[model samples]
Target: MTATQFRCLLACLPDPLTARVVRLQRYVLVSLDCTGCQEVGVLLKLALLSARAGDLPAAETVLHLAERTLRALAGHDHTFAPPRITRLHRPRPRPARSAAAPSPGPALAGQVARWTGTRPLVAATDASWKRGHGGMGFLTTDGRWGIGDWKVGPQDPTGPSKIIITELRAVQLLLSTVEARVEMTVLIDSLPALSYLWRWQSGDVSALPPGYEAPHLRLLARRVADRPRLRFQHVKGHSGHLLNEAADSLAAIARRRAPGFDVEARASDLVDSFLTSWNQQISA
Candidate 1:
């Protein structure tokens, strides 16, 4: 079938179901010679449906079979990008100044007074920074884990290198791994990350960090906003919280696995200056 015909077929399916299927089928049909090949087409669709329904392991197994089947029929190398888990991105908020601490308010005071609660689903998150790239991870009380790393793109030399971005990303990954609408407590050791979340939760956007990471922080806040019952808890690192220690270990591993490059050392100095000035101004 033509690409248009295949698209029309996918359009008839439900959105969530069609999205995953489209990822698999678009690559197979457009990149490979799969026109009029009913067997391979059926296998691709089955894999897509299974993955969309949360049977990811089964879908991967079937996809391997389909890959072999396609190679047997087409007699050439064929490949498709594996499906990626979707994260929520919505309700984008306006960016504020870089590393700007919110003016002293009752919300901040209240958070300090009322920061004692725990849930069964506990996620302890941490980040490790190198010169250019950084790694972050979150480990739950129940053994679920999410780990990842980010680095400045060689093409984007102006990117910020603050470690708080990695910390925020770890919280975002932890929240994404858990079910939505379920109450969960996230323990993070970064004071800046915790402060940012408290400010965002209080709807005080003016009191957000400044820099290239401001918009990304706003994005992370939007995800937290969706889960009204979610809570952020500050925990001291290296104080022997096993889950936090595990997350720290995972983050270190990810940092080791991250690609090494020449890090621009001046970024940290600049950020420190900003923080120092901001703190002085707040104190005055």
Candidate 2:
């Protein structure tokens, strides 16, 4: 069947039935000897169709099958090669930075010298999403931290996009609490959030996804533009990074609506030890 016809048929069926059909089709396609380019195209369409039907497992299975089929076909047919199946969305090429763009390190140092006249503070930020609610947390080098939560709105993008939005919200919350004149280095785990910040820093405001007009995102762009002393660095999540782990735990606590703990609490003591060890390591 044509992809259009298959999609129309899937639209008519109930979700459970559609999922079963998707699984069955994946099995059948995997078993077939798909030698021709047209057959490979059909498999690609089927994979896309399965994904659109919300049968992600079946879609992944079909994609693997398609990849294997293409590889086998390539061994015999020199004219045809498989395309990269994993990269569903190719990123747009970024323009080169203009000569007027300020270097982050030197520019931040100059700003700090003119304003704060002290060393820049280091901070790590993290976010957690559960049950349509997002919690954000940030911990600074000075042993200060903050946690906040946001509810998912009807206007916000759902699914995977929501996590990216939440990550951005975490940054926005951090920016709101901190003084703009204070030179600070913010560490985040989300690449998409960092990408948006970097793009905004380069004066490219149109880099955000189409139809993604979150108010917090606009505010974040403006704040980042205004504060040239703010430097963003990426930290890998779930690693043994002390401040990141503490920030992550705080975010989880906020999201779960757990009991509040004072600075002398057990969690605080643990974080204090972490900070001490981190400081010792840095000084060493």
RMSD of each: 17.7, 20.7
Q: Which 10 residues in a row give candidate 1 its minimum summed lDDT?
A: 104-113
Per-model TM-score versus the true fold: 0.51, 0.52
Clashing pairs in 1: 97-210, 98-209, 98-210, 98-211, 99-209, 99-210
Off by over 4 Å in 1: 1-119, 155-161, 205-207, 213-215, 258-284
> Model 1 over residues 231-259: C-alpha lDDT tens digits?
88898999866556666876765565412
Best lDDT among the predictions, by candidate number: 2
> Across residues 109-147, which tens digit of lDDT does each residue of candidate 2 receive?
001111222245887888898778777766677666555
Error of 1 at 89 (Å): 35
Give me the displacement of residue 244 in model 1, in angstroms. Answer: 1.2
What does candidate 1 score on TM?
0.51
